[model samples]
Target chain A: MTDLTRLTIAEAREKLRAREISSSELTGAFLDAIETANPHLNAYVKVTPEKAREMAKASDERLAKGEGGELEGIPLGIKDLFATEGVHTQACSHILDRFEPRYESTVTANLWADGAVMLGKLNMDEFAMGSSNETSYYGQVVNPWKKEGSNQALVPGGSSGGSAAAVAARLCMGATATDTGGSIRQPAAFTGTVGIKPTYGRCSRWGTVAFASSLDQAGPIAHTVRDSAILLKSMASVDPKDTTSVDRPVPNYEDAIGRSVKGLKIGIPSEYRVEGMPAAIDELWQRGIEWLKDAGAEIVELSLPHTKYALPAYYIVAPAEASSNLARYDGVRYGLRESGKDIIDMYENTRAAGFGDEVKRRVLIGTYVLSAGYYDAYYLKAQKVRTLIKRDFDIAWADGVDAILTPTTPDAAFAPGEITDPVTMYLNDVFTVTVNMAGLPGISVPAGLSESGLPLGLQLIGKPFEEETLFQLGQVIEDAAGRFQPQEWWAS
Target chain B: MSVDIDTVKRVARLARIKVSDQEAERMTGELNGILQFVEQLGEVDISGVEPMTSVVEQTMKKRQDKVTDGNKAGDIVANAPVSEDNFFVVPKVVE
Candidate 1:
């Protein structure tokens, strides 16, 4: 039999429906793969073997009864950010040590309802704060893809690093990931996988650990474009629990996979061609435009004048919101708590010991921005620039642009500790934060190999609630570039 | 506009996260580096642009006000570090 672990969600679905493979067998294959690859990759923080078997058994019964959910019997890794009932739901932060929620996050609940089996909780940056997975308290998640012949350990871009690496290494068919300032797209770009950050509120935030409430969104990372589409259809829904979740129906995203992109106006933002962008990334971006053009997408040159200010504004607004949201972890309720002389001292000590450096830095920055004296200059000013950034895209859309295309990251994956300065790390989100700023949807499609044979991706940003368009365009790029997989370095 | 150790200390106090003199010193330089980078926002002419509180424009979603949830204090306190009578226990603040 073909390797069960190698099947895409769509391919697995067909085989299971045809009775060529049982859910138990498929789930077991993935469990075996995880047992072998997880130690080296550090992708999974907690593996739920018993829960997976139980879920797969249920799925087999459903399949036997000729009734199964869209993702019946498929195994997927859950990013530790989501609260899984009675399961580990720490956001890879010391603050959430050993915490497990009784209630399931709405996104994970939706997946389980579709009969997807839980593989494990994937690792991520503490509080989903950093660009590289190095901020994870569980230690950095190593990217499965290494540079050409060097055995140097590269970072899986984060805070969705584990999800990206797991899917890349075929430890899971697909994985749930979140994005706040490019967590999903940047990591997906780094690991040769497909990741989409649906429009804000496309999926419920009821159970996912809050990062920056306004910018945080849940989506999927998958090995194939169609797999991402399939996973997203099951993951997205309107929930009464999350008032921000839109009341629109979740469309069958798989239908968009082969949809025609002919005559589609794909805007290429001139501002994205920033100074000092790596030559290989530039060449990949040019190749992306040619691929789209060949597939009949009309590439139009455009300018987002406020693009340069996006990173600056994002740092302010995200931190401000993060400081507010993270205040709930005061050592009174769930998670870690350190002893102190009194209540005030306890709060301080608990937080000081609990949060990692990046999380602390962000929380402090958040508090600083929202402070009485600096609120107007930093927080309020950044909010105003956020408006201008969103308006830039609105203006382009008014000019009949169906979707905007750009390089996913400034460069491909970098080795751990390669970029130490926070400012340099912040630049990883330069090409992606604008999509979040505008509440638009974006997807990263692995498009080309770098000079060192590492994968690079191109992003397609779509209008609000128009993920279908991104999937269509992403498939075009995917079909053109073909799929990329790192050789079995971890397993070996 | 630069973040000095004093600024880091003050911000840490406000955020309720304790930091020592050494961490604060290191943080001062790091925070200043970020502040210097974000200060570029000053270059943009955002005159008269309304501050966007949220990208998705929506009003407060209203539903018929009634008891919709609750009655699960056990579940709520299940993950608490310390609990008593299904209530989260915290360090005593009262005299």
Candidate 2:
């Protein structure tokens, strides 16, 4: 009741380690908060307090032995997209609403091994196809921050809306997030929290329900840049279970935080300074540049000439892969089986009834783009543009730019349902999608607030496996921000 | 750009979704809007642009052409809705 809400994982860990609190005590605070706030926020799809309490008791016992993994005693809100053994991981769709897996995803298992308590699964866009959480079958997520005297509900950003809203509201300290194209960063930006999409293959995806097999990467969303870095470090492990997961050694991300950014070069791509971008975003970006300059870092103007093509290319590639990846859900092996007299009827009936409108749209687009007659026109063309987008970044990075900084979303989070057409909504990821396509690392740090009191986010994209630089730049940008996105949801 | 509602119906069939006639008509308009939006990219001449897959400039690792999945017949059929004598039960394809 004393607003134990906004405390970071480190703060909670320190409190517990000092015997000032127990893991049960910390978990109780969040459990209480979830009960009090979840109906209003829809941040959590499920809450396993008994399971959480058991984990907390074990963590407290572990602390009694002076042994702690990096994330010990931490209560994490997992995106429902990850499979949890015996827990319903529906990917926020009715099709999988009853589909509880018998196996846990590598990421969730690793976090559990690191001693993190499961606060239960958070909501996500249905199959993570939409940029805004509104597409979720469970319902839309409201932004934790509301303008004074206005009853207009705002978006918490999507497809990780529930994760962002929960973390922003302090219902959980950190939530696991996945990004194929800005699912993590866009929601983080909308909620005024920190979210990172690590280099592709940084985290194992064996149990994750796939959206785009070629592009999906999972990371963490939390209250601070350092906390995001810590959570990311624990979640990433090279797993033999995931064929696409690279066997790269995980780096010491915690050590990289608070490092000086003196003499670091930040690239400012003029192309990203899009026309009609909100003025508040511009001011926040300029402030970020000034922060770097004040820290003895140099700013350079660069051009990613193929920037305009990224959004189109991503639409083609993401949907194409999503179509194929989702082909597994055809009422056969597992999940929401529909009984029909004939085999073909069973597959069609289950899928047609199971999937929502947005999911169906992606499946159609995906099939169309990959079809024999049109594959060369759409999918192949997009692949070519994808190459140019990558080359554009290669040229800039090769030009001696250490990292590129841009507004994570071209605009701050919008009022829920303001976007009617889906493509306009998909365009929201114009800035963040390129990084996922390039298999590079990008982090969204809160820059400041807009005049309307919504959070503005500055995205820092680093070269492949250059997460340390992202953390470094993120810290500098955080200092310049000076204002936390209004997270009033916790106090209430 | 003449639009065709029949193509939308065909797409829904291929996607295995039973879209109502009304929904198909609506989808035709929406799909056209998306195609128009994406058509903006065609303005930029990618005349000789090379298609690239994997965003990372590095090459993907190739797996040996060995069979790692052939022996899992029992496991593959474990979740089958209908199975008979270790074989997945599908409706007879031809008479």
Candidate 3:
């Protein structure tokens, strides 16, 4: 039989319902694939085989009685950011050493409610802080896609690197990921998969580790646009535990997969053509515009003047919130604890030894911005810039623009350690951060391959609570560019 | 705005994360690099914009001040690093 691990969520759903494959049989296939490929890919931080088998057995029994749920019997990898009951839920940080949550995150609760089987916890940047997954205490996740004719390993983008790599490598049907700035979209773009960061408060943030609370939103990374839509429909819901979650019905997002983009106005921001952008990225953006135009959609040239300031402003705001959010990891609480002579010294020692360098850097920067004298100059100013960034999008929408399009990342995946400077690394979120600043939904769909044969994605930004439009436009791009999967080299 | 060694040290203390002199030196350089990059934000004209804290414009949900669910002390303290008699243990604050 062909690899069951290679099936999409939709494909697996059909086969499971037809009684062609048992849920346990499907779960076993992925476990075998993970056992063979994970050592080289490093996509998963921890594998829960016993838990997976138990869940798969339950799903199989449910299916036998015609009681299958939407995600019944499908194996999915979860990012380390989400809390799974009694599982290793570290956000790939040493500070969260040996910590396991007794309760499930609301997002994961929703998935489990719909009968999705657990594969394991995937790796990510430490505290979801870096552009590359290098800051993780478990080490960096290797991208499955390599430049043609090269033996060197490349990065699977960060924060959700493991989630993207796992889906792209066919280790799991799909994976859940988060985005503060561009954690989900950038990694998806880098690894040639589909990722969506839903609007703020679209999903509950109760059990997930906080990065930038106002900016962090949960979404999914999957192999196809329809698969991403399917996973997101199961993932999103309102919760009393999260006050920000909107009390609105989640539209059946999969219905929007084949929706025509006819008569929709797509905006192309002039400022996204930044200086030093590579020609290939520009060509990809142009191709995306042409694809939408061919689909009977009107393309409009627009301006987001504050776009250039997004990266800098994000650095200020995200770290400022992160520093406040991450302060709860004290020695007295759960997780790692280093001994000291006194309470104060104990906190200092535990935090100093537990956090990675990148995490410490962000914490210090956040503290500096939110400190006594600099609050008005740094934190307040960044918030104001954030307002302007949102207003730019609001204005475009008010002018009848249905969605905005841009290149997902400035470039395709870079070699591990290729970017050393912090400022240069921050630029990876240049095209995607404005969406977060506006608290809007954005998605990266694999559009085409780069010159070196690695995949590149084009991003579409949608208005608040209008993820359906993005799915519609993303599928148009997906249909035009076709699907891309990397040749299997991890097994070799 | 350059981040000096003392500023880095002060911020680390404020954040309650211990940093040695060597780590502080490296942190100073990285923090300065980030601050310098974000200095461009100072140029934007924002005389009347309000700082956006949350993106969704919704009123805070209100409910009666009643305990909906609780009293599971074991579940709450199950993951604590140190617990005694179902209470979280911390260093004594008072002499």
User: Which of the predicted structures, 1 or 2, would earn the higher lDDT when compared with the native?
Assistant: 1
Tens-digit lDDT string for candidate 1 (A402-451): 99999999999999989999999999999999988888999999999999
- How does candidate 2 fare on TM-score? 0.94
Q: What tens digits encode model 3's per-residue C-alpha lDDT throughout A1-492?
A: 338887889999999988899999999999989998999999999999999999999999999998978999999999999999999999998888888988999999999999999999999999899888988999989999999999889999988999999999989999999999999999999999999999998999999999999899999999999999999999999899888889889899999989889999999999999898888899999999999999999999999999999999999999999999999999776898887878898899989999998888888899999999999999999999999999999999999999999999999999989999988999999999999999999999999998999999999999999999999999999999999999889777
Docking class of 1: high
lDDT of each: 0.93, 0.84, 0.93
Every candidate's DockQ is 0.85, 0.48, 0.81
Candidate 1 chain A: 10-residue stretch with minimal lDDT: A1-10
Could you tell me the interface RMSD of model 2? 2.3
Candidate 3, DockQ score (0 to 1): 0.81
Residue B68 lDDT (model 1):
88
Question: How should the candidates be ordered by lDDT, best one leading?
Answer: 1, 3, 2
Error of 2 at A422 (Å): 1.2
Q: Which residue pairs show backbone clashes in model 3?
A: none
